[model samples]
Target: MKPFTDGDFIKTVIIQAATRWFPGEDNRRDFMNIVQNTRLSPATITRKVNVMADHVHEQLNIDLKKCVRFSIHLDESTDKTDTAQLVVMIRFVLENGSVQEELLELIPLTRKTTGLDVYLSKKNSILAHEVPLEKLVAVTTDDAPSMTGKITGFSGQCLRDPDFPRFLSFHCIITPRSILWENFKYKNRV
Candidate 1:
């Protein structure tokens, strides 16, 4: 709470507190404790944070439109409470020759995550972003059956769909080959 007079600094404080799960009362107290007589209630902070998020989302959409080509990476895993979460990331090269990689979405699957489920969710996200499937050059995923299984996996579904553009599919390996080779050598030594 060191004296912060800048408006952007104030906004950053609110955003950080909100993201860090600070209670409403704590945020209010912190503002009150500030040297300046700034007024920031819990509700106001929440509203401001929401506005900031909306602005950032709009900027991301604009950036997506400027992408020359892009690739996606999908990974599905269960949370601590057994809730399935599909994490989608995107790597895109802008027209300016700069590449940007970002988290596109984290969709929580209310039901069990099947290959079809993943495909539909990803499709919706792509449509929402207004990104053409043709611009997608590749997709990377963890070699899970739901992601790679023929006829039932996400890539399989994409292959069957005529609307989907031709794109390379890859499996991201979790373990390094060197470590695997070392383990193999140790096991064979006995």
Candidate 2:
């Protein structure tokens, strides 16, 4: 048997990092060097980080299940790694009537990003989280043609779906409303 419990030692490292109690990587290496016996490999640390991230992801899905009506906010941007990525977030009314926004996932686009591709990626992520089509109250995306173009766009494709809520499939308003309102007021004043 090992002299020390690996699980406990690894958890201690996770806790320190979580609480921002981590001193420095060099400090940790120096300490481990001094200990010699309990020194964990770099690979082992990486594995533990992946394990914790998976646990957090599972918990987020569980939390998302509690909200009935949710609006998906989709944005496309390059990640730190310079890979094209899509970021998905959700805003929902909680049980207490407070709105909560949670970042759901990041999806890397391995190929060309078309309207169909964005729509499918969003659909897959939502389905994987077990958020039903009925509960998807809205989809908010940027004004980019791939997302909002009147034809062959993500919003247009959604509108074609019989299951899609006709009233909510259109993206959350981000523009034009103010312009229209101003025009109306100006005409009325004149």
Give one digit per residue, the lDDT tens place, for model 1 in 1-190.
Answer: 4332345566666656653555677776675456245545556566777899899889888999989999999988888999989889999999999999988899998875789999999999999988767888999987678898779899999888888888999988673555799889999995
TM-score of 2: 0.64
lDDT of each: 0.82, 0.73
Minimal lDDT window, size 10, model 1: 1-10
For residue 18, what is the lDDT in candidate 2? 41
Scored against the true structure, residue 116 in model 1 reaches a CA lDDT of 94
For residues 21-130, write the lDDT of model 2, one tens digit per residue. 44677766655544555546666656777899899888777767777677888777767887778888888876678788888888898777788888788878878988
Model 1 residue runs over 4 Å out of place are 1-35, 175-190
- lDDT for position 57 in model 1: 84
At residue 93, candidate 2 shows an lDDT of: 72
**Could you list the CA RMSD of all candidates, in the order they appear?**
9.4, 10.9
Model 2 CA deviation exceeding 4 Å by range: 1-39, 79-83, 167-190
